[model samples]
Target: MTTTNLSGLVAATYTPLNDEGDLNLRAIPSMVDHLLAQGIEGLYVCGSTGEGMSLTSDERRAVAEAYVQATAKRIPVIVQVGHNSVREASQLAKHAQAIGADVISATCPSYFKVSDVATLVQTMGEVASGAPELPFYYYHIPSLTGSAIDMGEFLLQAGDRIPNLVGLKYTDTKLFDFQHCLELQDGRFDVVWGCDEMLLGALATGARAGIGSTYNIAAPLYRRIIDAFATSNVEEARRWQSKSIELIRTIGKFPFHPAMKAILEMRGLKVGGCRLPQGRLSKADAASLRNELEVIGFDVEQAGGLAPAE
Candidate 1:
């Protein structure tokens, strides 16, 4: 099996919208750098947490382009180009490659109850085949995709069917399957944790990385966890990884996407509020969030002034 340097213990951030509800494209690069600086080895460009399903195709393309240009070869950028439309997904994949995105990943298209398993596999297979030049990671989040299948079987078949397929983002809560996939597909694929809450457990398995939403705020914890483990500081890594999960509980309690945006807004980037149907944080909620950040040793006032590094 060919190797790809794409196991990403990454933070999936929301695309900030202005108060006017337009995407704050300008913030893309710095947010990218901030995560990388905080010791995120890699990042997933657009995911459910990114409001990817909420953005228009043109908006998605523009965001991907901005990330590519801003990073300027700084780190790997995995663009999430999955859409309900296969053609659109393929188009986004092609565009992502053209713009110099390092890897391409997509979740299973969730239109209905997933039709059948083969259809599910075939859909992603098409994407893998389409962007044969770039490595692809299959994203598994049954809650978001409404489909379930044997990940082990999928990877076994995927290896043969898709020449460039290299990884999996196991997001579902049932991690035994992820572990099984990790063991079964070991050396054939890189398995990244989709659920941030269980990152340490994922890391404990052969799985070495993650793609999570909460890392946007508490990236320091991620760094410590990985570094501690690298130095064989298992006890320290466990403590830090547990802290990472505990920190996420508060952020996770907040309707997730918007709360992350509010933190970014507090950081001085004008990423917008969630459009209608997605609510913004109330002032009281924002204040409480700030307080929580302080409890976690973050300086809210200082945070408001710093620009997220590009």
Candidate 2:
């Protein structure tokens, strides 16, 4: 896969669904437009925020295709195709490439632990082989995956084998290791940070791009942080970053996925509730969240409405 580095805020999108948890294909267009209006740099579809693991492979494919079609190449779409079964991930990657996805990413198989670096590399290689023309990114979120392998070392060992191995979605909070990964091969990789609240810290450590679930609804706030940092306004950047952290904390009071969906609904897009195993927000809770958001200055009209980061 040929690769390019992406910068600024990339929103890890939610998979829109109906009340019955079925795919809501019609929601994609408006969702795309909304994100664009919010100044998101790109979309990371079928990842954790999108409930990739909860959806069937067929559903994931449909969601991926829908997002790609809706985006219409306005911004790059990075589809997460990781699965416990290597073959399934490869199949998904093939579909992503076939549908014109800009990039492909995969998390480590968490069900049956991948024992060592070589094995992990071999597994990811199989998935990349299926789509040789697209840039491949490893999604390293150890909290959920529990693999906890040294990411910097993983890159050193696997970077050469996976010909199109461009970089990773580094979600762990290990700054030392993260800095080491960025320094690898004289900083050849595109190591986008994944922690939303700590983005300022990541930027200080040299992260050029970041992907986060909150960016879907809070991109404008973060754009201020990025801009403030660019202009060396540490105090202003800190203020926005603190506000983002507070918003996340407030939203955490409710069931995570449902509350996030509700926030979007409150913002004028009724993309609907999450699937089974993930609960839904009540009208009362949605109203309360809106009130809290307003208190925190989550302007629906201006949410993520800043100019795109240069």
Worst 10 residues of 2 by lDDT: 301-310
lDDT scores of the candidates, listed in order: 0.75, 0.88
- Per-prediction TM-score, please? 0.90, 0.96
- Among all candidates shown, the one with the greatest TM-score: 2
Encode model 2's per-residue lDDT on 1-310: one tens digit a residue. 4567989999999998887778998888888998998899999999989999989999999999999999999899999999988899999999999999999999979999987899999999999887889999999998888898888889999998999889999998887788889989999888999999999999899989999999988888898999999999998898888888888888898888899998787666757998778878989988888787777666655555333222
Candidate 2 TM-score versus the reference? 0.96
Off by over 4 Å in 1: 1-3, 296-298, 301-310
lDDT at 144, model 1: 75
Residue 249, candidate 1: C-alpha displacement in angstroms = 1.6
Q: Identify the candidate with maximal lDDT.
A: 2
Can you give the lDDT of residue 193 in candidate 1? Answer: 79
Worst 10 residues of 1 by lDDT: 301-310
